[model samples]
Target: MYVATKGGERAIEAAHQWLAEERRGDRDVPELSIAQIREQMSLAVNRVMAEGSLYDPDLAALAIKQARGDLIEAIFLIRAYRTTLPRFGASLPVETGEMAITRRVSATFKDVPGGQVLGPTFDYTHRLLDFKLAAEGTTPEAQRKSADETPAPHILDLLDRDGLMEPLETSEDTPSDLTREPLEMPADRPLRLQALARGDEGFVLSLAYSTQRGYGRTHAFVGELRIGTCAVEMEIPELGFAVEIGEVELSECETVNQFTGSKTEPAQFTRGYGLVFGQNERKSISMSLVDRALRWEELGEDNTGAPAQDAEFVLYHCDNIQATGFLEHIKLPHYVDFQSELELIRRLRREAGAEEREAAE
Candidate 1:
């Protein structure tokens, strides 16, 4: 006795019309231009680009406007649009060493080679609201410094000289793309990092926080966190050499974790790495912490059964789109299923009542 619900198409169309009207609240008010959003709401645009796995800021800004400033929806729009575009060839892996550094910091050492440049960070800012911003005004530009010509060497590289940090192996093996391929269980570090890079920022942040509260204690130190622009090089077949095709803003983080050494080997500090699109330092840091927590098994540490330590658990539930879809689907009509359950409950009650009457007789 199941009947499909009717008027779904008409209802959807009506809902979209209402949404469009709401999006343009008060026609007298000036509409937000794409260029305005791209400049003023650049942080929102950056988040959309980072999570969507795309680099086009202009497109991201347009998606934000189209979605009525809904970031998740903007990310979805960008992701959907990206799939339709043709891929010519894979670009070479970015060289972080050649990055034109903007912001760089290290918690392990106060004085590093890069001089701990705190560029455009809110770390020292007071949390109080700036009422001055309520009035229409232009921000004054701060004093500037001459750009440093020397490329700062990675802090981990210094530790590597003394063999204090675990040696990282360079491989020519290509990493798996989660978008193109199906995600398998017991995923490798590369796959886990890929999933985490595009994962929900808040979810990743909470999970990382949980580890610090002793769910999966990974005595971690911020080895180095850097934000900068790096050149994207692609190998030219005819020229037989790699050439810079473009440049992208990147946020990179490296965490130094406590080591677990065997009897045969000396104890050395383990490392966790995170690299993300745009200047998303919070996500990059969270990614590094979660990355380190997930590496417990490979590093010869026991599984503490922490949520962050479970690779399968973390990777499966981190996606906002998948989680949002499943969560929102509950709003759909389930009258037939509910009626069936109701019928079964009535039958069970009737049988029980009859048995009681017979026993009394």
Candidate 2:
């Protein structure tokens, strides 16, 4: 059996210094600017903001730089920094209906009122690599018409108007923040949605995909997907009115799901909702699917034993920070434990050899 190594603080410090140098790469190249990262890597910044539950692009960009381009680390940094800031007050729930939409699409209806506005999407791109981009060549901007001034109404509202979709009741209850409180089982819809909104995007996406692949099919149809800026309002008691605090970019998705009515009620379409920090349709759509799957019990549907349907499982393992911490902790010193195992194995081998020799004699 062997003992653990002695202290290595000096070695740890040297390793960190080496890591810093490696992070910088070639000193001859100009260092990446925060502005460049904010603009060029805006998707990464959006992910940090969404996962961190803080909507400051500048801070997210700075975190991205400090994290050496690790998105999860950037999210962790933003989440840590957010806790240090003072809480002024809570803003009023955003009015998504009044959003100045930049992008809007619906799979259910091709041409609805306020036609499909395919703005700044890669959906139609041929995916061909352009060699010119490597040399800093610029492509001419696509032709565009003036944006419609009127706010585009959500397409799901039409189905709601006709009583075809599930009725959504508005409530004034404050939502519980998962970050502030300990996560408990049997989470409510608001709590589940909150967990999903900030959950690891890829993890949630995988679970959502599982649902679509007949693990717990919801037969979801994209009723509407919208990306836009909406004003955040805060009610001021002294002012006796609500005032616009600021604007935040958001992606909202509404999914129309199939629901055969139980013996007590008539058949109707159900709704699955998703709202995220920025123009992230993939995350939003996936969130909606997962949200619907988790609602199986409430909807009077039988549990299909799907991973996404398990609220406790999904919520507990969704945070990348927590997952990464536990995973990386395996790399920590376990020399004593391994040494004990090694000694036991050696003793067992020696005993088996002696037993064989005696049998031969």
Predicted structure 1, TM vs. truth: 0.95
Best by lDDT: 2
lDDT per residue as tens, model 2, 267-300: 9999888999988889999999999999988888
**lDDT tens digits, residues 311-345, model 1?**
99999998887788889888988888888999999
- Segments of candidate 1 deviating more than 4 angstroms: 4-6, 145-149
User: How well does model 1 score by local distance difference test?
Assistant: 0.89
lDDT of 2: 0.89
Candidate 2: stretches off by over 4 Å: 1-7, 145-149, 344-361
Quantify all predictions' global Cα lDDT against the true fold.
Answer: 0.89, 0.89
Model 2: which ten-residue window has the lowest total lDDT? 1-10
Against the true structure, candidate 2 reaches a TM-score of: 0.93
